[model samples]
Target: MRHTGADARTTLQKGFHEPVEKPKRFYKTVETTPVDGGFGVLLDGRNLRTPGGVRLVLPTAALAEEIAGEWRAQGETIEMADMHATRLANTATGAVPNSREATAGQVMDYAASDLLLYFAEEPQALVERQTEQWGAVLLRAEEEARLSFVRAAGIIHQRQPEESLERVRQIALGLDDFGLAGLAFGAALFGSSILAIAVQRSWITAEQAFELSRLDEAFQQEQWGVDAEAAERTDRLRSEAAALERWFKALRT
Candidate 1:
């Protein structure tokens, strides 16, 4: 038996085959309230807290209403997967407070070995495609990120300049907790911090970034026929990237 992308996402959503205990929906109404700094969601008359027990105060009333809408949409059983906005807010409030620096470091590590920096040594067609598509993105990175990355022909380890890494680190560090979480998620999903940054800055749409990141994989799938599992993975990746793009936009506004 082969594990699938859906299987992995299921595991991520519902821990390791854990029993799904359906909590009875107790709240009659979901609403938003103005807090000190921002707004928060209220169920009935009680304020909603994150899984970490902190008051779920969002920076914007719009975002708070969005999260409240998620709660309102739930029926008898709350589908956690459907509440991506709430989950992202929870991460921004809970996890990111303690792990901001570490998370930024992890994203910087990805920049060091970014997928865009590696080119395939192959037939002329594939090489040309990489140069045309990936090359444009690299140039965008150089211009936007203000750093010149070292590209390599093959998998041989080539060290990126320290100045380039520092520039990326500076950009990552400048993002707020919500933006940081989205960037980390997007970078990991697409395997390119450049694409993730471009999407974050609205230079390109999530679909464009996903397509560019999977250029080689798509080429292979077209030539050799697509595997069911591989196609499923691509769908899941696109969905996640779209979600991240939405979250980033909401967070910025």
Candidate 2:
């Protein structure tokens, strides 16, 4: 009988599967308060947006600028025509996008999130990539959902619709919690999409996402000699993200 070491290890590794819970980290839930009878970002009882109504959450300057740049190059607001999964502000549910490119705010939000998170976790030297991506649009369209929530909230406060059906669109704290869980579980294998949504939606910190990504990359690199730990971690994180997406999907279904 010939036995390979790999087979033995595989069998042994499966034996360690225990009924344990995963730890949740990288979040600091402040609080929520009502603004004009709607939800507002809060730190305990204080309103995040006050006086002028700008969000109190830390803004990612590079992100906001990149989206603005795209608009400048295009001569007007822009949006993807074939954005299948990219749910824009009103496009997702069949409403005009503020008489603009029809539905680009969310796209900008998605792209901005990409810039913010990349710069956030990235070293200062390599953080200038947004300048190059200004005229380019290369991101998963589905991620625009994050921006939808942010914009929806702003619009909610502004319009104060009699019905306010848009409230149904709000992503709950649980989704944020789930996204964070998935990121930590990946421990570096976390996808940019998840992190992008988080920051754009103002859930987790960009610094945390960047740091986790670096650690995950480092962990995987260390295993290159004999194993693909990074790949393994990524696979697991993918599963988690899929689960979070599923939860959200189920609600819509």
Candidate 3:
């Protein structure tokens, strides 16, 4: 779909506006306590709830502590936008459970036309660069998924194999709610399901994924000078990608 930095940045930043009336922090101590599922963050001995008003329970104590760290880091005013772990935890406990199938469907849809599958027809350098950087990731995906993907040049809309798409679907369907949230977030952030899976599996670092996802723009920037606005947008996406990587790491603990 030719998703540039601007496109993915817009997706990540969508509906992420800071509250006009920021609430002052009213809690003294931030902690985690065992809950029904795993652990829940406690603010001054009171249970913390998601924005949707659901009890914020996590699958692991480590993840719960991570969320608690966010709350502890807040200043006098709570900035929800800065609480990536808490926001993601909210999605995991609140929205993702109810929309698991729809989330998996979205992942499959992105896999159908994943950015890694597309190549530039012209500019031998860009084409070669795409092949060199993207080929290994696609190969690894095929090996792991036991399915082959169709490659397209110049964005002519080449269809990936149904079996391949189904394989990706199964991969997405197998994740727990928290993993699913990370996968869905990464897929949207990178605009490539393959890249998202690669990062989630530790096959590639988030920095590498970000670079690969923006290869086209990087090459263009190399040719025609970098744009300040575009660079700023990509910088924000880079930070968010790093935060997602940390979240995945915390999920392992």
Candidate 4:
């Protein structure tokens, strides 16, 4: 059986929750072709299309190859969740273009309540670690983006400067659809807009972002030992972060 771009998009939207009924691989060849915009993927001589039925054209040759590689890796059956590049490409080509403004707004929202802005007041050691790690990243975002942020000690909300948030909004608006999609994914995944931007800007690796985001959980695990469920969750998140990082790298190459 063959899969359509719409099928791929649906699988991505559902994520790993619902089990996808894998389809038998039908294409004998997966190759990259030069499209007018950049590069395109061809399977058995037919051009790949997006969920919206638009020709799937990537912005870079490297990215095209990455998506093609996913298709090439399929065995007797195709598993949509495993094709990270294709899922992201489906989003960029079909979903993101239509929701660009909404996507940018979501990123700005993440910046407003970024995880890095809050610190634990009770634990001195956690405070010191967060100050040392998250603080550094937040400071870099302010320095580089020319923005100001307010930190909170506990659950009470501290409003960031309006000027700073507007700057972040502008920064989000500046990205193209694909870039915005990547930014939104990273921000939501890491639960910190500053950390996401750090990874997006090449200031930090995906692994560092995961480590910084999981600081509280890691601290708890160290003290009380790890829960089986939490560890599994962390592993899944780590893999997704790495996949997003790979997608970003491919776009730049």
TM-scores, in order shown? Answer: 0.86, 0.25, 0.93, 0.91
RMSD of each: 4.1, 22.6, 1.9, 6.3
Residue 160, candidate 1: Cα error in Å is 0.8
* Per-residue lDDT of candidate 2, residues 1-253 (tens digit): 1111122224323623565443322223344343452333443355443224444321222222222232233322223221112222112113331222312222222222222223223443333333233112223222444232111111112222222112212332223322322222222223333343454344444444443334424433555642566456444444434433432332223
In TM-score terms, candidate 2 sits at 0.25
- Candidate 1 residues 67-151, lDDT tens each? 8888999999787766778888888888987998888886777778877888889967888998998898788888877869898
Instruction: List ranges where model 4 is wrong by over 4 Å.
Output: 1-15
**Candidate 2, lDDT over the whole model:** 0.31
Compared with the true structure, all predictions reach lDDT values of 0.78, 0.31, 0.86, 0.80
**Highest lDDT among the candidates is held by which one?**
3
* Ranking 2 against 4 by lDDT, winner: 4
Candidate 4 contains a number of clashing pairs equal to: 0
What is the Cα-based TM-score of model 4? Answer: 0.91
Question: What's the candidate order when arranged by decreasing TM-score?
Answer: 3, 4, 1, 2
| Candidate 3 clashes between residue pairs 3 or more apart in a chain or in different chains | none
Better of 1 and 2 by lDDT: 1
